[model samples]
Target: MSLATSIRRNLFVLVGLGGIALSAQGAAAQPLDSALAAAYVNNPTLNAQRAGTRATDENVSKALSGYRPTLNGGISAGFQATRIRTPGALTAYENLWPATFALTAAQTLFDGFITANSTEAAESQVRGSRETLRNTEQQVLLDGVTAYMNVIQAIALLDLQRQNLAALEQELRATRDRFNVGEVTRTDVAQAEARVADAQYGVSQAIANLSASRAVYRQVIGVEPGKLTFPASIERMLPSNVDRVISLGLSQHPAIKASQFAVDAALFQVKVAEGTLMPNLSLQGQLSQGYDSSISVESTGAAAVTLNLSVPIYQGGVEYANIRQSKELLSQARIEVDVNRDAIRAQAVQFWGAFEAAKSQIQAAQAAVAANTLALQGVREEWRVGQRTTTDVLNAQRDLTNSRSALVVAQRDRVVAAYSLVSTVGKLDAQSLRLKVRAYNPVTHYEQVRDSWAGLRTPDGQ
Candidate 1:
């Protein structure tokens, strides 16, 4: 073969291989559902939030400890010497050793609502923690959806840019041939070349955007996303009414629930503070055995049981201040709950409206894509027949590409909105969604450890 023909054949082979590689790379991308699931399981931020929730369950143990008895033990042995003198006379010295040991147990028999209120507060705190974790999970889920949609959008834009580049190359070639035949001006060829360059630049920019978007997707979903199949529709996932949507959000939103728990805890603080003004009764017992090497020089054992009462006299207004501070905190918590409810309602309205508008945009974009496709075909045919200029065909092609990209964006928006609405309703927990992983159950673990106090144990009879 001639050297020129050999060069041309090698160029064709390279182009073919490049196309195959691009196709394979696109195909290797993971599906969106799988990416989301992976994110749920592996995302470090979400796992950290889960750990925080588990830590909150420790409050249950703290609360239950108030109901249990406290036991303490101590032992001591010592020797002492004493010297006695009469005026200026000689002095006499004596040494003595003593040992003492005590084992003490105290059980709260009665306190003016302190222990009860504290336990209630701890329970509320646990609830609050779970809700906060749920809120964090929902936010993470939304971020994942956004990242996924962004990747899809960038990919679609990249495809459009590539197609435009190909079309522009073909047009440039045709214009060059026409110029050689003296049918088209040099200016026309230059314009075609400029368009091709611009299209190539567009392709480069799209690729950059796709890369950045993929990084974000990996950050949220905990893995590199692969090719994704578009959903058929997302309208079915949207809520029906704005009022109902707001109501559901207010009832289930984690922030609001957490605030409610805060209020409960604050109220409990007030009770605990009030309990300081009343007497506390406790049952106490002690048993001990010790040896002394002094005058007695013997082992001693003692057992005794006693009832004790402690009354708070005054603490320079500290108790009153605590009560006032707790009351103020309770008031702030109540206000926060209301504020959260209002904010959630407003967000529901906004997202629901966006979802509805996105549905319309999808329909309109789909129609636009169809119309622009036909328009581009007509413009291409007119140019071929010498009835239209190259500019006209190029313009139609650009419009068609834009319309297709818009359609993909609209489709993604619709799906994201659907997910947002679901998240707003607070049913976004893994168990509620029937996710594959085992849901973390804080209550079960709390129950298991709550009654086991630090110093309390089961009785011998049991």
Candidate 2:
């Protein structure tokens, strides 16, 4: 049988064990999409990033506060006592109670456009945060795919190891029978025994590897792996060529977009800093009532309104320093955009190469497995007819087993490389994959809280 067919047959044999593993969760096929969806909603890292983005949305509300008015009220109550004594007069004492109530309001009429520039900067930051969240989502999904494929590959390898051990044990038994009948020498039996022992060691290693892979799968998928269905090929969803992939990555990658937004925010921040060197104007009003229980024994009220303007006259040169610092930050932000673009471009090239290389590797591995399978059969037949030695047969078996293992690894790499390429081009997301889960919309939270005037709690009441 072809190596691919043999692998599939062995995979079917593993279904019963996989089913038992999932018995607690109720046996069902855990497809790749399900794992991705679970991670999207449940992975702590991804969820924490989402929460961070939501917090970033609050920057807009804080910036908008510059355009609003501030009001405050206060009340005070106290007792005043006085004692007087003169040389010719009797002592006199007086106690009086005093109370006051006040209300004050202040509004910023103008601030050299600092408020406007700050608000615009905050909005740009919000957009940048959304892009950052998108990049995080893509990373989480890619990790999910990688973890899922790792478990599958480990399981397949373990199965191949066990099969190799069984075959070696059968060959050892046959060699022993020949030794007993004087058809083979004691050295032949010893050689077969040593090969069997090595095969046993391989089985142990495979088991350990499988266990480690399952642990990683649990950590990433938020659950123990079950009867994982093999994922279908995604090549059809990929771009036509490396050039197309790189082009898309340069234009569509979230990291680049996020950095671009950062540049915009920094540019506005520079404007805000420059505004600090200009005049600030505001208006203030206050009303108060005071009452006293003294000789006057009456209440008095007062009201006042003031228009305030403050011109900066070199207050320690901090404003100028801030403007210079903001300009430097703007330059850094612009550089970061180019950095991200170059990074995405390089990733696009690397993954595309891996994707194509893995495809060719699969074909080459399949051909090697086919050739090694026939060679082993022929070597065994020749050994039976006294034309080949026991060492030759053992060598043939080893070669066949190695080829099969290579085939398994190549198959896994092909699938993973395809997914990785998709991610490099900025398309590996829940929306693009049409995963069966509700999408988390960062814009919803931003829209809900952008114009909020006052709130001690978040939009979700947390």
Candidate 3:
């Protein structure tokens, strides 16, 4: 080959490789599934909720301790001096060193219903905490989905704006050529230039929006988003019946379950308070050894056992007042359960309606895009033939741009609405979605610690 041709071919190859590199960079910047999964695992809000749930696991131990014996031990060493004096008689003084040690245990034999009811209440609290954590997870997931959809929509709109700008640039060049030939006015070229500038501005705004959305996505999911691939058919992801959704939400929604658990816990509290008005019986045992030089050179040891009963006569009516307060709190909890149920039902209906509306809007926007594209093409042809004014061409371009933007928005809204509906029905958990993360188990920790007090006692069951 000639030297000039070889250089030209090399330059073309370099340009092609550069274009590919740019394309790859753009693709790498897109949010992906792995990013979302990482975000799901590492999000701080979700982690905090998990920590809160773990903290409640301690309640199980606190409750179970009531059924177990408590053992305590202590040791002390001290010095003492005593003196005796009589008027006009000889005085006597003595100094002695003493050491003492003891171990004691007590077991509750009966406490009316306080211990049992209190333990039950703690168990209910643990369950409530678990449900609250699950609810937090659902909220985080929904936020992640919303931010993801927003970024995708913004990217789509930015792409549309770029295409619009390219078309306007071409029209500007054409209008300038026609004006040079004295066929079109300078106003045509000026309008085309203004449209191109407007499209560029839209692209800038879209980019800014995408950045903001990505920040929110990162905030919720706890990691930077990688290249993302969304489901092609978002409508198919939605459930059909609002009634079924409401039923599921009422049954499984964490807020509703938590409220119910609160009521149960409050009922137990009332029982515990009423138990305080009765009598408590406990068995206590102790073993001790002491040494005193003044009394003996050797140590003395003693063992004792006792039964104790505590009968409450009066404490300013505090116990009764507490029971009354618990009853009122229980009533509030019941009301909360009702409120949560109604709220879930309303949210389900709204999300279902939104999903359907977004679907319809998508179809309408798609048709508008097609119609606008054809109309713009017709106007361009007419302009070439000096049959269409500059304003008509500009109007058609604006319409086309609007249709494209609307279509992107509608597509995003449909996906978000579908996810919202799923969330409203309380089925947004990892198990429900079959997500590939280890499910958090609250029971194992609770079981590990609940009976720990039994192990704290001496081998002889002190």
Candidate 4:
């Protein structure tokens, strides 16, 4: 479509254009889903969180080490001088090298369940980190949506401002012609000139706003935005009411789940700390070889094994203090779950209300645009017929421009608020959105590292 025609009908009204439209350069419009996919795949903040979760996965491996045996080896070599005398009949002096090699292993039979509790705590922490990653993903996607819509809205408003400027410039020329013919006074032309200057300033502001939006789009979506297609309707995917929405937020929000997992981890940590006060049982074995180069002695080999038990006898009050500290942390984590729920509830209500209000505002803005468009046309004709003044025409034009701008903003708000609500309810993920991108599987990393005995490289060989 021509730029002028597109501006007049409003780009959003062209939703029937094959579910996709061509930009001014005749390229296929970039869909919002594509932008979201880009953000999911390439946004640095989201990827950093993924890395953090992978790092958290190592905690389980470290914790599991407590269940494994430890083996160590040692070697020592030295030169020795020996002198022997036997009842004044014979005396001998000799130089020899003595060497020793030893290997030792220790296996824990029991440690008051400390290993088990620590492993459990580590696993819980991994789960919580995964949830935190999910929350970060949701945030990145929401930011992507907002940035995408802002760019589109800025572009549309800029177009409207330029169009308004063109219209006012034309009006100024007409007013000057009328003044020359003595049909209007100098004051009328002056008024038209002032309005033109205001329209010019509006265009500059619109350009600056568009620039700002583009920069944000790049930051969030990981690429400069091309002509972005208006997002598909999310109303069908939304919950039916505020109550249902809040319920979803409470149950499905990643922040709440993360907090709950933190509570589990903290509870396990408390047990781990308490385990320190219990007796520890372990078995140890050692093998040693000693060699001496001399006339009579060559080498000796020996092995030994021992079962060891350690009962804590209160060396200090540190263990008790640790137990108390762990309990306090557990309490804090429990409270954090409730805090997340409350925050999610508040956000759900706020975004839902904003979404609903945006819908109403769109309707009102459409009506206002329609009315103001008609009023401007009428005022222009009346001015030509000498029934309306220059100020009336200028005011009518400004009203129409403002209404169009409001319509664009309302449209942007509706789309952004819908996505924000989805995010608040914890549904704004790659699977939920069905974006055509490979989803990052944090579980795959956790599973790969869990119970693994040895590896210097990560799952991705990094």
Candidate 5:
């Protein structure tokens, strides 16, 4: 709504509201789902987290390596000479050439369950990394949603500002006409001119803010925002009450999941460290050949299999120190789980409050806009009949503009806050929202790579 009826009708065209938008060379019909999909599929930060999780998955294979056999081969060649001197020696000197090639293999029969525990620890880390990735996805998607809404909010504010400018220009023209006819004084016309300038300044500020919001939208969503239509409200998707929200958040938050997994991994790490104090058993085999030891015409070969045993009696207390350190880390990890739970609860409560605030603000702003629209209309008419001053009309217009802008901002905050609450509950991902894009599965890489003896290429050959 605008103070001037003529400008109100032209408002849509004057500021591109609810119509074709002035943006990049594409159809201006971007939807929230598409924006989120783009961020999920192509956002570098989220994709990097995916890569980091995949990398973590490889640790499982590395830890599993302890259970596998190790093979090594080597070759060597050398010359040997000996000289003997006595009163009457059988032979004064003797020379021989020696060469050997050896291949050794060792397979661990037992290592105090080190491989099993380490593999479990690595697997826990993989789980933690996956949960971390999910958290990142939620954050990235929420950021995209917020950025989109910010752009749309900025556009609406700028449009309202332009509407204010147009309304003020209309008032200024009328005041100028009345003053020319000696009906209104020059001071009224001057006041109208000053208000028009202020409205123009407001429009400029809105334009600058819109530009900044667009930049952020482009950065978050990976493309310049097109003309955006308001997506359907997700308030229905949120928990009905704060208690339910906190319950869901505690049960499902990715930070909590990740922290829990970290604690498990740390416990396993403690086991791994303690494993070093135990004895290890392994089976080893070696084969060697010696050639050209007798006038270049003799050769000899040998083969042996040995059971190797190693018991760590004491070695500067490093193993005990490592065990102590790992236990301390496990303790820290357990404490961090509780810390993450509290942090997520705080986030849930904070976002829920924000959502409520937005609701109240929206209602209040809407009422203010309605009342100020009426006041502006009345003030303009009273000015027409010398019952009110130009200053009154200007103040009414400003009040209406501020109220409308506040309503727009509150509407934007409502959407952002709703999505943020969903994220805090770890349900803001594509799977939760049933997005169109196929979800990235971190387990696929883990299953493909884990237990693999050797490989240079990835599962998909990349």
Candidate 6:
């Protein structure tokens, strides 16, 4: 019989403990999408970053406040006592209760266009924050993918180890039976027993590794891993060419976008600093009513309006210092944008290379698995027919087990590399994936709060 057919026939002959291990492998494994969805909703890291993004949206409204009027009112009541002294007249003392109430309104008419420039800067910062959120989403989703794959890989390795142990045990029993019938020596049976014990140790180690992977899955996905599904390789989803991947990263990666906005925000800061040396114009109005009760009660009311203009001659040299400082910051911000661009380009190239390497590894490993499978079958038949020794059969079985394990590892690496490559180009976001969840729009809160006239509460009533 052909060696390929022989392995299959022998595999079917396991109605024993080995068959149970084979059958117990995950039939309905958990889907990768499910883990990502869970992490999107429940991951503390992502949620915290969302909160940070929402906080950033408020800065725009604060900058816009400079263009709005402010009104304030106050009231004061107190008792006053006064004594008058004259050289040739009797002293007079007056005791009274006095109260005053006033309302004031102030509005900025001009401030070298500081309000407008500040508002623009804040808006750019909001854009930067939104991009930061996008980057965080990619990171979290990538983590979820990694964790899910680790669980699947761990389960596969553990199942393989269990099967190896079961196979070794059966081989040990067969060797002892042969020895009892005088077909094999005691040393051969002893060697088989030693192999079975070693296989048991390997099974124990696999169990530990699988447990550790499960814990990591729970931490990243916010729940225990349950029946992890076999990952369908996403190799076909890769870009057609490496150049396209780098192009995507440079144009669309969230980190690069965030840095671009940072540069804009810093430039606006320079404008804001320069505005401080220009003239400031404003309007102020006040109304006051006062009541007094002493010998006789009296009340008075007054109203006034004022226009104020301030030109700074020299502000203790602070204005020029601030302008110079902001210019330096602007320079730094511009350089950071280029830094982000180059870094993401490197990442795109690196992950693409990893994906290519892992793809090749999978192909080579699969070939090895098939070859080792055939070898094991041939060796077993030769040993039975007295052409191969028991040691040769055992070595062939071990080689087949190792080849299968290698194939499993290569498959896992292939999926992880694909995910990393996709993430490096910033396509691993919820919007890109079309995930079935309520998308958190930072603009929602910004729009609701930007034009608001007055409110102490946040847009979400927080």
RMSD to the true structure for each prediction, in A, is: 7.3, 3.4, 7.4, 3.2, 3.2, 3.9
Model 3: residue 261 alpha-carbon error in angstroms: 1.8
Q: Tell me which of candidates 3 and 4 scores higher on lDDT.
A: 4
Candidate 1 per-residue C-alpha lDDT over 1-462 given as tens digits, one digit per residue, 9 for 90 to 100: 554554344333222221222223536755555666777888889889877776677677787777889999998878878787898899978776777889999999998878898888888888888888788888887788789778777777787788889988998898888789887788888889888889999999999999999899888998777666453343455568888788899988898898998898888888988888999999999999877645445677889999999988987999999889889989999999999988888889988988889889977876676677667777877887788887887788788777767776776777788888888888666665555666666666566566655444322222
- Candidate 3 Cα outliers beyond 4 Å, as residue runs: 1-36, 84-90, 232-237, 293-300, 454-462
lDDT of 6 by residue, 96-179 (tens): 889999999999999998999999999999999999999999999999998887776777778778888898888888888888
**Model 3: per-residue lDDT, tens digit, 159-262?**
67777788788878887888899998888788888988988898898779878877887787776556555543434545668888788888878889988998
Which ten contiguous residues of candidate 6 have the minimum total lDDT?
14-23
Q: What would the per-residue lDDT of candidate 4 be over residues 309-389, giving only the tens digit for each residue?
A: 999998789999999999999999999998999999999899999999999998898778767767877788899999999
Overall lDDT per candidate, in order of appearance: 0.77, 0.85, 0.77, 0.89, 0.86, 0.82
> Candidate 4, 431: how far from true, in Å?
1.2
- Off-target runs (Cα >4 Å) in candidate 6 are 1-3, 6-29, 85-90, 177-194, 233-236, 293-297, 385-391
Clashing pairs in 2: none
Q: Point to the candidate with the largest lDDT.
A: 4
lDDT of 2 by residue, 1-462 (tens): 765675455434432233323212465678888989888888888889899999999899999999999999999999999787999999998787889999999999999999999999999999999889899888888889888888887877787788889988989998999899999999999999999999999999988988898888888778888777668778888999999998988888889989999999999999999999889999999999998846456788999999999999988988899999999999999999989988888888888888788778767876676677777778888989999999998998898778777767777777788888788788889999999999999999999999999879988888
The TM-score values for the models, in the order shown, are: 0.85, 0.92, 0.87, 0.92, 0.91, 0.89
Give the per-residue Cα lDDT of candidate 2 at 356.
81
Model 2 residue 293 lDDT?
Answer: 45
Range of the 10 consecutive residues with the lowest summed lDDT in candidate 1: 14-23
Which residue pairs does candidate 6 place in steric collision? 29-228, 29-229, 30-228, 30-229
Query: Residue 449 lDDT in model 4?
Result: 92
